[model samples]
Target: AQLNISGNVTIHRGSETLEDSKLVTELHNTEDNAYDIIVTENDDESSSSDEKEEDAKQIEPNRIEEAFQVKYQGTTLETFCSRLKLFHDEWYQQIKPYAPYLTIIQSSGSGKTRLVGELRTKGIYILYICERHECSSGYPASTPYVQKILETIRDYKFGALLSIAIKEIKNKNWSAEEFWNIQIKDDHKAECNDFWRSVFKSLLQQKKPSSDSRDENFVKKLFHKASIVCCIDEAHELLAKATKAKDDETYFVKWRRQIRDISWVGFFNILLSTSGKIGNFLPPVTQDTRSARSHDFVIFPAYLDVNTMDVLAPLAENVGKEYDYTRVVYLGIPLWGSLAQAGVSLINLVHLASQKIRNFSKKNNDHLANLACMACSLSLEVSPRIAEVDSLIASHMATALGVSLDRTSILCTYPSDPILASGALKGIIDVGWENCLDTLLELFSRGVVEAGERGELVNRILFSKAYADAVRECFPDSPVTYLQKVPLKLFLKSLLREEIDGLDELLNRMGIDEAEIGFNHWTSLLATNQKYVESGGMKFLTANLVIEAYHRHTAFKMPLGFPVIDHIIPFKYNAGYGIISIKTRIQKKTTFGAKDISSLIHPLNSFGKWKKGYKILGIYIDLGLDRENAVESKAELKSRNAPQTRSKNKNNEDKKDVKNDYDQIIYIQGVGSFKCCGKEISERLSKILFTRPWPLDTQWSEFDEKTDLKREDVIKTFLPLVFEQKQSLVDKWQLI
Candidate 1:
């Protein structure tokens, strides 16, 4: 009777292992076969145990011990085995009948390969392939770069046996000199090479009657009998081809389709697994015309849900327990940009800001910090600075309500005290408190702000894995003193000491006080200007307030124009006095003043054009406009601003007698820009996306060529640049 072993087996038939000696010769030799056998030693097995164990005491070799179990964190065996078993059982059941193409969405260090290996050990033949040169700590063999997987399959069976034999010979502890001394014949070497190929080809083409068969070949034959599961790792990278892959189409996609419809094999089990990504990759499923068989699709996400961040907490904890827990200090500044330019923006802003703080603290110089403080103050004064305030209030409300707070005045305001300015910081920017509240609430509905019960505000950039940690790492000792102590009052004070006093105070001292006096009344009062405060201050104040109001009101809930430029004045508004704007439209077809619309299109006048006597209303590209008399030539614009001139000739009648009329023209006089009927194209696109109002999905690539706005690069580069410039300007002028 043949006795079956319960535990691991050990090979102990001691035949002196030789140079390039096959493992099969060491084991029991089969009829007309000379193949190798690979074995692992167990703790209880001896090196030579062929004789009766009762008569001879078996001694295990010290060099060989039981195979070690793969452990988590280098010590503890993970308890995830039960969960893995359950998941695998469920998966096997669901995918057994149909040809299932699965995408397993998992993050790094999820033991994906090990689980697959264990499944293979359980008799499920999985043809595993991974990306070439894609190295991760958990997996040893990265993906094999073999062009053809069929070659790998053939070699896996026969080549593994050869490797085992070669390794055994190499382990003899003989030095190179002694090994070379032993003569091996050329015929013997040629025989070894031929044996390798013959065994591989025979096993791969298992239908052929075998003259001699090995144990490895038997396993391959068994595997080929049924549908094999091909498990691919890093499937995302495979699918994403920058140009073309093996063909004009993406290799991974094309290969997947080919594998799915392999006519030679009838519905072999196909499984594709990947970590769920929020990107476009998977191609639409094609219909099967031949047989009634079709590929079934399944997707598994890495993350559980947006609301719960703790679903993967256990896995994270397991890995982090050994390694240091990720320490992060999130700086939640409001910003967004293109994907390509994101890192640049974060580097420029985060690193530069951090270094500025460090340098200031080290040098005991408060000038730079004070400058930043002033800018922050000005922004606070001009804008509501709703992000921090609302999030703070929302957090407080959640505490009071004993639930997660939502973004509403009820959560973001003092519930007991109705007026917000009473407790929190206050400044009006022509935008009413009610409207500000609505804006904040709208941002919440859009999922920009989350109601964290804890002090943690959603740092969209930081919380996002792409930049947050990397950025934090980039700035090690970013002293928080500047931002931490940055109260609005202190910021305003810094503006006075550093910026406003040096310039405007000198102006006031020089009796350019008319301009200086007007500036003070219009902007925030610098401390130096308070001494020379005059009665006519209110006139300058009214003008500035009106202009600011025009811009705020016009742009509110309205669309802007293409190549959007909000020009203040044809000339720069530097004289410190406020500006005014005006617009005029000619009467319908009756013809009007010189038909001179030339002054409107000049780059200088393209922005702030003010006319005293004409009707002011908005105009659109109306089809009703009289095209017969309409003049749209360069010569017409050239003569438009010129003073009254007679018609040059009677032949110029068609040009000179071209009658003109305007429907309506909207203008914000000195404010220099008009607001139209829709949201900004960029903003509209964002709303359609992030909010998902429209059925069409938004992509950064969509606007790459369509708009002049390097939406991607501009957001990344300009936002932070504009912030710096405006901040510096505000500081120098003390406009907080």
Candidate 2:
């Protein structure tokens, strides 16, 4: 052709590979401003795999300074901002001239604080009041008291408002600490007065700073003129405090009313700023009030929503593994029968499951695993109580849900006494049940579980509904329904079978060997043994089976004529006895005598031995064989040689009543709550009271050394009605 060498050329002389090695030269002298170049060539040997992978991950220089992604309610920051009214535009059109009644509404953690910061930077002076004293993570554990607000204003612009407030507090010789002291006195009044004055002054001031304005005086004036936007974070706290008025409790009611009135007056002044009408303040909205206008109110509360959840999820994932929300619905199976019986939401279920895994890690002291499990558990919504009774429930939920132990760590938590915070749980659970509602709400807000609405739980059981239905389907017999007439022992045994199995088996197998301990642990066995008897397997099996055995063997007495189950070392030593005794009393199905003594009765001798002291009165049995040695008072017993309170019908009839019909071992008498007595003292007294089989109206026969009466006889007579209760010894078991 025309010999176009520029288009193509051959560099190799040989014909073997001249096509593969092309060499060409351009004939044109000028270059175009913009041109596209393309060429095809055979692939060369690639870089090593490791190097290639490294290069792939390397960030390019051009990608720097790109805007970070901001997620809010499943929307981008720019998108959200586009929809929200701009601060300046909003102030000018809706808030500015009103002298400052403005309300901002948004879920918590949604850039509200940042927005406030921006407004301050733009020279829009504001007053901020959060519901809580500080953020959840902030210290000293409560919202800042009203006193702090009165001391600082200028520093609000620097986001050092709290710090400045603290400084102001010190300047005024006050402390935030004093507010929470047990003894709140004059200091509280002073603080309240100071806070009131500060708030009043802040609301009333109305001026702006200028170039030639006196600096200190000008800031003060500007602060006064600024429209106050009392931002209440965790507004629920305020709402809660306002609703707790009692009948005839005018002080708190008056105080709350006054506060509302003040807030209303201030709000009206700001609303009528341009019109200069200070009389028309808005009414304060407590949570009890269903509705309130938001024209000038600003609140940021801990509310749960998808966007907040999304932010929380990633953090949760970082702490643990990602879990599908649906999986939580079926958590816990073995013990609860299914997730339905557990009555927990999916998130809560996951949290409970995760808690169990963490518990093992903590018990074993595996630092890394512990940390991981802890993080995972927290991610799933489990708290830090490593080993709690809730583990049983949590483990069951986890098994049902099919979540791995590590992932489900968050589900397990203490099974609060009340099902929720319903007052219906009065005697069924413990006192102070209402205090847990706040914690429950916090858990709900954190996505642990849905809170109860009104009086009912928000979530229903998912799979074990049938099991629960079956339970509700069954009804107790008339005999069983009347729990009081039934022997307490029988009721307790049935309860044991239902609630505690191992104890039931052990108690069944106990025989004489278990009795060797003299029913020392009865308090511990109280719940288990009582439940065993209550469910109805057999009769004569009270929680007191073990203690009754001992009662039959010994002889000591007290005033009430019922066996006094006292602590050995006394609960006051560690307060354990009081807790144990109350727990035992509630759980005991039969009288106190038959309850397991080992658990209930610790060794007071342990304390005594440690104290290097021996018994002042040597421990002994009141056997009638020593009748001749018996004595009552030094005066009465010296005169005769016979048993005290002997009946006129001294035949076997009275002795038969003592031997055959007698139920109680000894009588008990004490004025205060007996959280701290010992078993030895109690048992000794029981024998004394039961041995003689004396009546309150009976008189002494012989109070001498030759008589049956001895020095152990202290009381002469007592009432019998105090010892009355259900009489039974039914032995049964129930699985709880």
Candidate 3:
């Protein structure tokens, strides 16, 4: 009993164990079978023939015991076993008639291989295959890999017969891989598969009963009795070529097609593991994650959480390491945690963590760049920042990533006050990994101050103010520097440094702010001159607040051509400041139809020649005044600024003749790059997007307000007297 128990437990994965000599001998005796290259060493000095013969006859033997250091076994080792066993019993065996497979999603270096080692420590038979190298059997359908799997089962059966399961350091059956991949051919394939299957059936194993008469409970129990499991390391590599595995043309509409259908992959009891996002990997219709087969293989997330930190920092309770708990839980990858075990200071660890995260973000297509930016924007607050996310994903983050407080916040984020690391994800990018777009929408929705609903979080989305320092260390730019850079999520926050919103007020709040630094707003978003702040340095704004932002940015890049650069300007004003946007139109018969005119109502898409003029709605303002006619070529416009004479016969194909007559053309005298529209277009707009609308040709500088204007406050100017409309007509005006 003792020999059978813990028989297969190796001190570590890479143990130095030679193959059993008996198996090699037996295979050598088999027809066309040979293995094990062995060599005998002779002493340099030629020994006497009689002495050598005596030594060989006496069978000289050497024995030694190797010392092995047992690393920290996490507190959740039993939990790990329980989770896998439960999945195996309940769901894994339920489909035993078909295929039994489980997927374990774990981040890289989170001890996934070690966890399998732990199961082996209990004398469980596990065939670990490195998927990247060994999954392919050189056959079209991986016949050799599967054959080796059966052989591994037979080897275990031999161990059971002897009541002594041998433990080896090697992660897999290397000999099997060599023989199967190199020697096995299509001609002998059927014979080889038959031989392996017969050997597996005769092995001392728990025989699974026929499903015809066995009850569900009986079948599950039989599965539980069958302790053998095949775990493929880096199983996600099998999926790298494909997105979804099931009934789909392309695996994913967003990703590549022409991939294999892995939906019917479960040929035997298998465990597919990865270190990517669970929400992203599982197929929905067995491919789409949103509707992944719940009845299918279980998604076991082996996250490195606080228990891991406790294991690393055992004396954290006696010392003052409780304060650094959150930090370790968040950034305590095994490699970094080992540094903590060596008594590295918390400050050094934090600096190290910040650098690693930054470098990682930069390398992985900068998917986490927006997260870093959001962290910086919210870093001035004293308390830990929190945001809601999808409950299922949030649960994974909490347990696996160790970010949850109470273990359940399934609505948006798991645990109402989640671990601060919850904010970082790759969901926003088009070509990057999974994202958390909905999370951003949820957080921003609550942060809307202008909304009469006045949701929780009031005007602010709580975030660690000290994280701003981390962001600066990583990305060295202001909070709003990445607005257009992030085409997906438009995050906005206030820059006003109110004493009440200080970190000191949030001390009793969430944890993770071990630095406990109180920050003041030392950065300004806007200034009058270009010498002060750059256009990229402004605070983020939504569609409604975009006109002001458009004007500010226009001060930098004047005369932004069509498809109006007004995406920086927003038409919607529901969120705190207004969400700005830009739009493009599909023309009807090359004629500006009602649809074309109507497309501009949304402030983001409206035709506003950025910065100077009114945030025009309803129509494309094709300015048609000779002195200020918008030319097709920028060089011609520049030449006009210098008062260059026109060549009558320049053969300029770029010249657009403005022929159609319209209702109104509000031509500003000095402002060269401005927009004007017909009377119908003007009435449709009716002074909506901008703060205050005025007649055409008014000095672009007249409506400008610096400092004290509440932003919404209309400037009371000296030129209140309305000027009579005197504008250029659009009938046959040749603009060069």
Error of 3 at 216 (Å): 17
> Higher-TM-score candidate among 1 and 3?
3
- Candidate 1, residues 415-434: lDDT per residue as tens digits? 11101111111111112223
What is the lDDT for 105 in model 1?
27
Report lDDT (CA) for all predictions.
0.26, 0.24, 0.29
Residue 321's C-alpha lDDT in candidate 3? 17
TM-score of 2: 0.21
Model 2 C-alpha lDDT per residue in residues 288-333, reported as the tens digit of each score = 2232233343321111111211221222122322212232222111
Task: Quote the RMSD, in angstroms, for model 2.
Answer: 30.5
- Evaluated with TM-score, which candidate comes out highest? 3
Write down the worst ten-residue block by lDDT for model 2.
Answer: 454-463
- By the lDDT metric, which is better: model 2 or model 3? 3
Q: Which candidate, 1 or 2, has the higher lDDT? A: 1
